[model samples]
Structures are given as C-alpha cells and as structure tokens.
Target: MTNNKNQNLLLRSEHVWKVFGDGNEKKTILKDMSMSVHEGEFVAILGPSGSGKSTFLRVLSGLIPPTEGHVYMHEKELQGINNEVSIVFQNFALYPWLTVRKNVALGLLHSTISEEEKEKRITDAIHAIGLKGFDDAFPREISGGMKQRVGFARALVVQPTILMMDEPFSALDVLTAENLRHELLTLWLEKKIPTKTIIMVTHNIDEAVSMADKVCILSSNPGEIRVELEGLPVETRMQKGSDHTELVDSIYQIMTNPKKNPQTILHDGNHIPITLEESPYQVLPQIGISKLKAYIKKLMLQGGKESIRELNTNISLDDLLPLIEMMDILGLGGVEENRLFLTELGDAYAHGNTEEEKQILKKQLIANVSLIQFIMQQLEDGKHTIHTSDVLKHLHAYFPHQDAIIQLKTALTMGIYAGLFSYNRQTGRISLIEN
Candidate 1:
C-alpha cells in the first residue's frame, strides 16, 4: 500500500441524498452520506444489492445529481457531468457495429486534438488494455473479457483524472475476472494509465478487500456509510490469519448486527411466528437449496452448532450469512449466543433423500414465505392466476421497487422448484400447481 496520507483530496461528497420517484412513491436511496477520496488512491464502495452502491458511484462521477447535499471535485463544486471523470459500466457498453479501435476513438470525439494525435492515443489505449491486434475486431467477434478490455480502453483514451467502475468485471467468468483484476492492479501500480484515482462499486467482499486501498461499506434502505476501512494492502489481504482477516470479520459483524434494525417475523396461517432475519428484501435465499442442505449436514457433522466466527474461517461471510438467515427463515436453524445451530427440520433435510428434502422445503416455503402463502391463498380463492404486477405492488410495501421485483422473481423460482406454483414468464403471471 502506498502512503497517500499527504496526497491531495481528489473528490468528496457532503451530506449527499439520492431519492427516486416522487410524492407518496418516493424512496430514499442514499441518505446524508459523506466520504472522500484522495489522489493516487484506489477506493471501493462495498455493499449488498439495493444498497445504492452504484447510485453513489453515479453521483460521484457526476452522471446524476444528488437530491440534496453537494459533491466536490478538486475542492470545486461539481454541478454536472465532470469532464475529468469517466466510468466503465458492468455491461461493457460497447457498440456491436463498431470495431475496437472505432469504439476507443469515440472517447476522443469531443476532444480538440488533431486526428493524428487521436490515432496515437487510440492505439496506445488499445495496447494498454492488451487489445493490440484486435483493434479492428467488432464487439460480437471478441470474447466477453476482450469486450470489457475495449471498455477500459475507451475510458482510458479520454485520459480522465478519475475512473469510476460499476462492477466492471462482474460480467466475466471467474478466471477472466481474476485476470482483469490483476491487470488493473498492475496498471495502477505501474502508473501506465493517466488516471489519478479509481473508485469502484462492488458487492463482493473479497474483491473489495483485495483491491482497494480504502473500502466504504454502505447499509441499505436509505443507504448510508456504515463504516470506512483504510490502509488495507493487497499483500496483507492475501495473507490468511493476518490482521486483514480480523478487519474482514469486523465488517461482517457491522453488516449483520441485529441491533442495527428490527427483526420482522413472518407468520403462517396457524399464526406461528417464523423469523425472517437479515434485510427486508432478502426473502430469497442467496444459495441454492442443495448447497444449503450440504451446509446443514456440515454443521451437524460438527456437532450441530458452531460459533459464527469459527464457521467463517472456512466459508466467507457473504455465503455463510445468507445461508444461515435462510435456514432461520425456514425454521431449519437459529442463531443463539453468536452460535448457529441446526434444528430438527434442518437435520432431517440434511440426512434425507432428494425427494424428502424437497418436501421439507415445500412445507417450509408455504408456511414461512408470505409471498408464497399469498399466492396460494389467492389461488384457493378461485383467482386461478396472479399477475406479477400485483405481487410487485404487494412487495413494494416491504421493499424498494427494484428490490421488490427481484424478490418476486426469486420467490417464483423457489416456488416452482418446490412444486408450489408455476410462473409463466411469457405472460408474467403465477399460478398454483395441482399438488
């Protein structure tokens, strides 16, 4: 890690607030958030989905104005799109009809430079991004990794002072993403690119810890900066059992602290309360049922209970927390005294056959998941079918609009897998199965 304590302040946000919609439908995405980035620094904004991580990045790059507060670039107020800032989007944003060289050259279209200078810069940018001979290749002709390289080259050709990336490597395969991450780090360390600062938005905890000099964690549903971790070196993060691991653990603690929010319990028709811990929109399980069953078996093998910290030593908090929460939601497990323990249902599922496991899952989903119960009740009432829009409207009361859509889709998937309901994608409607 480079000592950037004496470096100049490149960008800062003060009491920033971003609100979507209007009147009664309005939702606050970011709230009173303030943070700063320095020159020669690599910063990461880390949070779960719907945490406004990308929205904050857009605000920082001046792609969108905040509903309140202010953003400063080089100590001056940023009013609109900052000419010195550029962004690389997750989808690569490449023109399929244009060749790599043409796409990169587009970055210089508004420049006052001569054609010869533009050609030189374009060639240099392409080469810098490791796309040398493929300059004439179209986006469709190259691999996903190469297309993302074109994205980097396009952003680099403009010679922006700050580069903002919205999960830039998320679209690639694991190996490809890893290669790109290393290549980016090499460029930043070698000073091959003219950009002075890099700000990235990501949900991957390991990615943030491995890449960024500083990490800012955001909480969801009116996102706010929950914590800022600094001075984390790549070397330190890679070293297991180091202080870096402790820092990562601390982050998980902050994110999962039950004290931060109220715990809402869903009730079945029998009026039995089922704990639905974690975020409001996290009604969907992040891991597949098979993986969850395997985790339960592992827990049982290890005496059916383990401290959260001990469990984290093997599995990442990202994977572990969601699985634990899902288990609790299904009445398969619970957390007590900071230890996770499997219940009778969880142990049975862990040892059961595939069909039996599915049965258990079906019963749990119908009983604990409100959306599933609502769909079933609607079907029983002779509705026959429920439009996805209606489900989204109901979910909107609990989650943000986008999150509501995601939760509904996830519920549909789980419901279909459990033989509870069938979703017609073409018609955007869900109907109960003849169980």
Candidate 2:
C-alpha cells in the first residue's frame, strides 16, 4: 500500500450531483458527493448494485458531466472526456476480430505518437500483462482471465495517470479473480504502470478490503458517500479472523442498518429536508423462496436467532446478508447488534406446510412490498390490468435501468407464486387475480 502521508491530491469531486431525467420524473443518482483521491492511493468505491457506482466513475472520468458541481483532475476542472484517465470495464470490451496486439494498440490510435512507438508500447503492455506469446490470439481464443488481462493491457497502453476499474474482475471465476487481483497488486507495488492512482467500483466487500488503501462506502437511492475508512494495512487483509474481518463486518452493518440516518441533499443551494418516507427503499434479497425458507428454518432451529458470525461459519456472508435483509423486509426477521432473529411471521413460515408458507408469503407481499401493493391498488382503480412499462417507469425512479428490470421481475415472480397477481409474458401486462 502507498503511504498516504505527504501525498498530493490527484483527483477531487466538489458537491457533485448526477441526476437522470428531467422535471417531476428526474431522479438523482449522486447527491452532494464530495471526495478526493491522493497520489499513489488505491481507492475502492463500495456499494450495493444500483447504487450508481458506475455513474460516479463515469462522472469522475469525465465521460458524463454531473448535473451540478464539479470534478477536478490534478486541480483542473475536467470537461468532456479526460484523456489522462482510462477505464477497464466489467465486461472485457474486446473486439472479436482484433488480436491481443491490435486491441492494445488501439489505445494509441488517437495519439500523436509514431507507429513504431505505438508498436513498442503495445508490445510492452501485452508482455507486462503476461500475454506476450498470445499477442496474436483473438478474444474468443482466450480464457476469461486472459481476456481481462488484455483489457488491462489496453488500458495500460494509454499510459493513464488514473486507472478506473468498473468491476474489472467481476466476470471471472473466483480463483481467476483472486489471481488477477494479486497480479494487479504486484503491478501497482512494482510501479510497472504509469497509473498514479487507481479508483475501483465493486460490490464485493472482501475484494474492496483486500485491495483498497481507502474504502468509500456509498449509500443507495441517490448514492452518497456515507463512510470512508482509510489506512487499512494490506497485511491485515490477508489474515483470516483479523481486525480486517471486523472492519468488513462493520461495513456490512453500516449498509444494512435500518435506522441509519438518511442522506441529506442540496436543493437550489439550500439543504433540503429528507423525510423518513423519502428514504431509500430497502433492497429485496435476490435469493429464491426455497433459500429464504431454509435459512429461516435454520434460524428457528438455532433458538430463533444467531450471531451473524456463527451463521457465516455455515454460509458465506455474501449469501447470508441478503437473506437476512429479505427476512427483515418481509417482516420475517431482522438484525439487531450482530445477531439475526426471526420474527413471529418468520417462525411461522419456518414451521408451516408448503401451502401455508405460500399463504404467509402472499400476505406479506400484499402488506409489505410497495410494488405489489401499487399493482393491487392500480387494479382497484378501475383497471384490472397494468402495463409492465408503467411499473418499470415507477421502479426506474428508484433504481438503475438494469436493477429496475430485476426488481420488477423479482416482485412479479413472488406475486405470481403467492397468487397475488398473474402476469402475461406475451403481453407484458400484469393483472390482479380475483379473490
């Protein structure tokens, strides 16, 4: 890790706000977000999906302009595309027809450099990323990890002062991701690249802890930088059961705490009051119904509650946190302190037969889930059917495009399973099932 003390500011954001849409339908993605990165620092931006991580990155990289405020690179206001910054995408954005050498050389196409110099830089980048012999290989001929290396090579060929990674290794298998992470660290430590700072956007908690010199946690529903932890030693991250684990757990708590203060916003240069009702909606767990049932049953068998750490011993935190949050959303359970406890509804569902479980879920869907209730209300408002586009528009106000689709699909699935509504896949319409 780089020494933070005496480092100069490399980049900064001043009260930046990114708002999509306009007028009444406008949705703010980033609000009054101010943060800075120092030279030689590896900063990880951690947030849940749909938290505008990628949007923030694009704003910082000058690919998109913020609706309000400013982003500065090296103390100068950034306008339009930033040539000093390069991004590695989640998907290896490599062309199928381009070989490794040609792909990497593409970065130099717009440069004033000579062809010979471009070839040298391309060769050096390809070799530096461990793709020397595979320079002639097409993207389809390479493994996922190797393809990502080509991404790194392409980005490096630009000789960027800042490297922006948007979940660069997320598409790889676990082992491959780990290996690439270590390789990246080795490159950073060895000063093999010209990158003065690295800013990564990731949803994986462990990956952030392991690689970041500083971790900035973003809160969703108008993503804001809620927490920033710095000076985390890389050595501590390598050890299991270390203080780093506790730090990771603390981040999880910060993200999951229901009563945590809502993020404040600036409206027309005045601090706008945020009502509790306007607070970010709780994210529904992405797990299936069976997984939710099994986990609730396990909690019940374990005296109706268990410490998250204990539960994690059997199931990974990646899998456990969502289920716990789902239980909380469904009024089935919640986390207090470090423990997870099942509510009366959760306990009943655990012991109930399949039919009874469905009944309980249906009741919860109608009572707890706002989307389902909205659909039900729409049906009651003289309309038996609602277009999926209408629901999607409603959801897009809260979530990103992809996440809005996921949330809508998930809600529709649950509603269908619970017999609350029937969706016509062919017509893209949803209708309430008559009682």
Candidate 3:
C-alpha cells in the first residue's frame, strides 16, 4: 500500500525530452528530466533564461507532451491536461471580453454543473483573489497586477488540486507584484480550498528559494537539474541569517558550478547525469566568489537589505565586476554583489523560513529592489519620478563615483514607484503614473 501510494505519484515525469525540430538535427530543450512533486508540496523549477524550465512546466501541466518521456498523475499516465491541474501563466491569460466573474466561470464551462454552482465558485474565487470589488471590471480596465489576480482566480475557480505557475508576477511593478505574492501565499496557507500542490517556473532565484518547499536548479542549456535545495518556511528562516545565508550560498555554488555531484541527484531513472567537472563561474574572470560572499554578508549585516548599487558604491570596488554583479542580481546574496543591500523589506521577508512565506518575501524583495532604489533616488533628487536624463544628472552630481552610471540606471529602471513613473517608449520620456 505504501508503494502504491508512492507510485500513485501526485505528478511524475520520466525521461522527459522535448525536442522541437525533426529528425537527427532535433533540438532538445528539456532532456532526460524526471521529477515527482507529491501532493501538497510547493515545488519550484528555477533556471536562467532558455533553461527549459518553462518547457518542463508545460509538459507537467499537460499543455504539451514530452517528446521522449511520460508523465503520470495518480499513477495513471496522463495523455493531456490533467483534471487535477490548472496552470497560470506569467501573462495572466485573462479574457479581455469577459468580466472577472465570467472569466473565472470559464474554467468550469466544460463541467456539467449548473449556472448557480458556477456563479458560486466564481464568486468564491473572486473573493479569494481579493477582487470582490472588481468583479465587474473588465480585464482591459484593470491594472496588470489585478488582471493577474483574475487569472489566478479563474484557475482557482476550477478547484484544481495542483497549481502550475509560470512567472505570474513578471509583468507587475514591484509593489503590486509584492502585494500579490503576499496575498497568494496567505491564500495558499489558509487552505480555503484544496490546492495540494504547486509547481512554478521562475527566472528569479530568490523567488524559488523563498517560496518553494524544494527548489530545483536547472542548467542553462540542455536544462538539467543541477541542484535541488529545500527551503524552510518564512516563519522559521528569518531568525538566523547566518544559517539561511549559508543555505543560499550552497545553492549559489550548485548554480555557479556546472558540475553536479551524485548527492544533488534523485535516484530515479528520469534524471540525467551530466559529467562536467568545470565550474560555470570559472569560465568568467576571477573576482573571488568568497570576497563577494563576504561583501554581501557584511552589507546585509549593516544595511539589512538595501539597494545593491548603493551598497556597491559605498564598498568602493575598483572594478564593477560582472561575476559579483551577476550573483547579487540573481538574488543569491543578500545584496547583489557590490550592488544593493538587504532593505527593511528584505529583512522582513528573510525572517520567514517556510517556503510559502519565503517565496512571498522573495518575490516581494526581487520585484521591489528597483522600485525602492528609484524611490530613494527621487527623494535624493528632491523630486519624485523624473526623466532618465534628469536622474543621470543627479548621478553625475555624485561625480568621480565609479558607480554613477550603474547607480542611476539601476535606480531608474529598478526600485522605484511604478505608479509614480511612466516611460513613454516612443518619446523616451518617463513621467509619474497619475494616481
């Protein structure tokens, strides 16, 4: 019975390979990847761009079948979209023509249930997603963040046991995205409904480390799982920075080093054994990962979690090194190496040890890094969101500072108030979002 239960895998993929082209020249995006996410576990598949994380997600959700392997849910092989699974994409695939109520109800359109029951489910989903007041609002009229809520609500209305998300917060401004992440975590924790499993694909490492019970790191190409790390929930993780930071460092090592050890692998036949011994970071010029690790630790200790560019500037590194920059930009360190520190926002988030809480906090922090910097820069400039050149002028005021360009640009694009800044893509002028 125990074996049966384990075999009745909530979701399983064996030897999955998604090949795009035909024949011998076939391009394999996801190769020999097999993983099982049990019922009620929140799992995150993380990787850099083009890492096939998204492809893996689509296969698991039954949106696309793997060219090589097989997928099973409930121990029964899945041929198409699993009845127990629902996917939420980064684009928030809400119906522009439909109202929020109708959009959610669409999920159950194929069901034999009556209209009354459908409306009830829709209503419940709306409230669950904090869109009670906006039920009448069309997708076109609402903010990008709110539209995503509708998409989530629609997915939830079907009452799927598993949730598959792909960068759902990628489109929103930092504050709005953070707010959504919190709401989603709260709902997931409250267990108002029966969502037992969540498998999300994200480019954001911090999101993976914070929100997932288990984080699977995929290599850049061929999309293999380089490392799998467990995350403590937000409640438990934040108490000790050293321990958590170390845990993060280990994950960073797994990612930065292309070489994988046997310890990182699952014994299942689905996982591939890549025998490369060289570290990925070694390919780049040396800036000393330990130095960066120390720098970030020191910065976080002092600033908690502040702007990366500001922290880097304060530290006064002679060269604006790319490797360290990449580490922090990826959220492996408290501050992006030589960049920002953990802000008050980050400190509050790092406090959570639970995957759900950490995920929420991670999402919030990553999205807002730019927003916070922008806000701070605005305050320094004695005005709210202004044109890029105007901010550049302020950066120039900090003349002779090596990070003048890096700081100003990051501030403009990253941690600012989204509602307070509007960029005219055509004109190249940035204005504040009207309240």
Please tell me which predicted candidate would have the highest lDDT against the true structure. 2
User: For residues 307-328, what per-residue lDDT tens digits would candidate 1 score against the true structure?
Assistant: 7778877977667867877888
- Each candidate: how many clashes? 0, 0, 40
TM-scores, each model vs. reference: 0.68, 0.75, 0.61
RMSD of candidate 2 to the truth, in angstroms, is 6.2
Candidate 2 vs 3: which has more lDDT: 2
Off by over 4 Å in 1: 1-5, 234-244, 258-340, 343-435
TM-score of 2: 0.75
Q: What shift in Å separates residue 183 of candidate 3 from its native position after superposition?
A: 1.7
Q: Against the correct fold, how does model 1 do in TM-score?
A: 0.68
**What lDDT does the true structure give each of the candidates?**
0.80, 0.82, 0.63
Candidate 3 lDDT by residue in tens digits, 1-435: 011012234888998988786543355678788788887677889776667988899888888998988999977899988888888989888778998777888889887788888888888888888898997888899989888988898889888989889998878888898788777766776667668888889875555665666778787446776655666565543234665655555555455444446255334344334565442112222234345435545655775644433443454322223434434443544333323445454444345444433354335434445433444456446554455666555545432233344444443443222233556657655654433
Clashing pairs in 2: none
Question: Per-residue alpha-carbon lDDT of model 2 for 232-350, expressed as tens digits?
Answer: 57656545556777767666666665345423111122222233335344456677777888889989999999988678779765567578768887899988766889898888989
Q: Give the number of the best model, judged by TM-score.
A: 2
